[model samples]
Target: TVNELRRQRKLMEKLSMEDHLTGLPNRRAFFDCAERQVEFSKRKSEAMALLYLDLNDFKGVNDTLGHDVGDELLKSVGKRLSTVCRKSDLIARMGGDEFVYVLPSTGKKGSREAETRIHQAFEDPFSVKGRSLKLTASVGIAVFPDDGKTIRELLIVADEKMYENKEKLSRESKRVTIT
Candidate 1:
């Protein structure tokens, strides 16, 4: 029984980085992997990317539908995002409606491609609570060793970009004119 307990403990530790809800890696685990990538990039003098994303109109979904449906939608989004990302990429939920991704050994081109893929993933409809829901996400990206020398700075820049995207969307939403 003791050996069995030890084995189970090891398995749990291995899976600790994963988010139980969305099955994406959790924030703590993501940071651990990102730190390693940052160190490697520093040595090779290569560029890496950090992408910060937030679901657009997610709060409206919760308000219009319910929290249960909102949770299901998040899980679906995570699954779709995982399919679009490379095996080397790290995707994680930073709590609430926020997510962060790390693309090691990738620069501007890679970041652009990844962002495009993610946006395309959201173009499809998601089934939640037996209903279809359309969703969009705002993405902000920062390149390592160019945008910031530290992870904190990278996250701040990425968050700033995300907020800028949100503001743009809000402005666009108010611009529709009906004849």
Candidate 2:
């Protein structure tokens, strides 16, 4: 009886920690790990990076292809992100088309490398329901101490930068159209 109960508890704990769709860490689990990592980094005086990524034109996919296809795309994106990110790093879906990456002990070079890897991961088309769809993401990066001392502050800055990057892209596309 004790062993059975222990197994059930473990199952519940794992379920609580993972995203139902992507099987990646959920926001709660991610935040817990991120906070611990931040504290550790603070103690070691090491730099870390947090990246906020938003899928570009994700709403359009849902609008045109429907929710099923959108869900598939999201799952595929999550899988690819996991592959590109360091094994020690944590990638979590913050719901919808937004994802967060916690890169521990990552400096400027590692951050750029992670960014490049993430970009490259999306270069290949994702196949869903016998259809291949191209996708892109707007990424905002924040380094600890430089951007924020705390995880919450880092998230805020990263979110702002992500939106700013998306806005810049929008402006550039508009300029091209006007020209």
Q: Pick the candidate with the highest TM-score.
A: 2
lDDT of 2 by residue, 1-179 (tens): 99999999999999999999999999989899999999999999999999999988888788888999889989999999999887889999989999999999997778878888898998778888878888778888999978999999999999999899889877765210100
Q: Cα lDDT of all candidates, in order?
A: 0.87, 0.88
TM-score of 1: 0.92
Backbone clashes for every candidate come to: 0, 0
TM-score of 2: 0.93
| Residue-level lDDT for 81 in candidate 2 | 95
Clashing pairs in 2: none
Q: Candidate 1, residues 20-92: lDDT per residue as tens digits? A: 7898889888888888888899999999999999998888888878899889989998998889888888999
Worst 10 residues of 2 by lDDT: 170-179
Which candidate leads the pack in lDDT?
2
RMSD of 1: 3.4
